[model samples]
Target: MRFRKRVLLYLVPAFVIYSAFMLIPLLMSMRVALYEYTGIGDMTFIGLDNFQRLLFESPYADRFINAITNTLEFFLYTMVFQNVTALLLALALTRGLKLTGLFRTIIFIPVTISILMIGFIWTLILNPNIGVLNQFLEVIGLEAWATAWLGNEATALPTVAVVNAWQYTGLMVMLFIAGIQSIPEDRFEAARLDGAKGWNIFRHIIFPAIIPIVGIVTIMTLMGVFNQFDLIYAMVGSTGGPNYAVDLLGTLFYRTAFGGVGGQVPQMGLGAAIATMTFFYDLYVCHRHALY
Candidate 1:
């Protein structure tokens, strides 16, 4: 009993810090969502009016729905492109190829860089006129394939999603590589001895061994997608321009709580409500996954 008490005592400091930074602020945000505040005046007790306005009222409702749609679409894109690419790369790297360590280091370099810097660099690279991508296309006599990647509404969100995937895919690759390497070497030899090769070996041995890691990666990707802000903010402004094609929950919350490009009014109450909903949604997803 004394040992358990000492262990609990050691954890108290970290728990207090977490409560101070994360739990307390989350509760405050939920409380703020029940009031009407514009950052300057006194907060008025408005009950669930902010949430109602966000979900059922005009203009706000439209924007909320649009943000939800875009956020989900972004998640889908990352899940399909980012995670699959990581799994494939991890499988290849685990095969004892030459310069495997060098390849892994090179791939993970982007993950070590600042996300804001990644967004900024990609923005320049995707620029319509002077960007490397368009210039390369032109040099190869495929100029028609190049266009304003970030400026066009049809391509903005997907382009941002791709850039995000590119930046984070390396992290996922390292994770998958770890999972693959954890499998016993005897398992691979046995499969090979039984004439299993290529896809057969992966399906029977490697994939099953990495199932737990796959689940972890999926949950991490989901949480990361929902909480995404910095990359989008750096690449596109809080307005999520190009006709709001890339507007996400994070940008919506920022635009509401702190006003956008044009001198728009700050709706702190509505912003808090949006944030509260997003928080609950993420919590629910995590809870469901935990239960399963």
Candidate 2:
């Protein structure tokens, strides 16, 4: 009883902070979604009307759908590019190569930098007219392949996705490395003794041992992708330019709630509705993952 009491006491501060920040704000947003508010004057209660408008109305529905599609694409890109690359890099780093520490530091450097700064830097690099990337392409006789990466609708979202993947890949690599290192050395020794090499060792030992870490990385990626805003905003602006090709739920909610985009009247209730839906969807995904 005393030990349980001590544990509960230790948890109280964290639980309080979490409730004060996360839980309260989430409940308030859900409540706000059931009303009509414009960030000023009076708020009118309008049970589920905002959700109805968001789902079935004209412009709102279209933009919401677009944001959902883009967010999913962003998550998919991160899973494929970021997680895969991290896994590969982690595998390589675990091979006891020389200067592994230096390589790990280089990979993780980008994660320590500001997302906005990274966005600005990449924007300069991807610029069509004067960017280093285009200049390099020209030098290599591939000038025809160089184009307006951030300005073209076809490439804008994918380009931003790649940038995001680059910024966070290091963190994923570290997680994977930790997972790989946690595997018993005896397992690898046994595998080698059994004539297992390279792919077989990884398939039979590393991969199975790190399944939990993979799940953790996937959940983190999913949450991060849904909450992605700053990098996209810094790279493409609040309107998610190139005709909103790069817009995600986070950008959509911010623009609607705060009127960050030109000529957009702030719709606090509708923004809250968007947020509420996203929160629930994320919750559902997390719950499903937990069940599995």
Worst 10 residues of 2 by lDDT: 258-267
Q: Which digits, one per residue and each the tens of the lDDT, describe model 1 over residues 1-292? A: 9999999999999999999999999999999999999999799999999999998999999999999999999989998889999999999999899999999999989988999899889999999978999999999999998999988998899899999899889999999999999999999899999999999999999899999899889999988988888998999889886888999999999999989888999999999999999999988988988886
TM-score winner = 1
CA lDDT of each candidate? Answer: 0.92, 0.94
Candidate 1, backbone clash total: 0
Task: Report the Cα RMSD per candidate.
Answer: 1.2, 1.5
Worst 10 residues of 1 by lDDT: 235-244
Strongest candidate by lDDT: 2
lDDT of 2 by residue, 174-254 (tens): 999999999999999999999999999989999999999999999999999998999999999988868999999999999
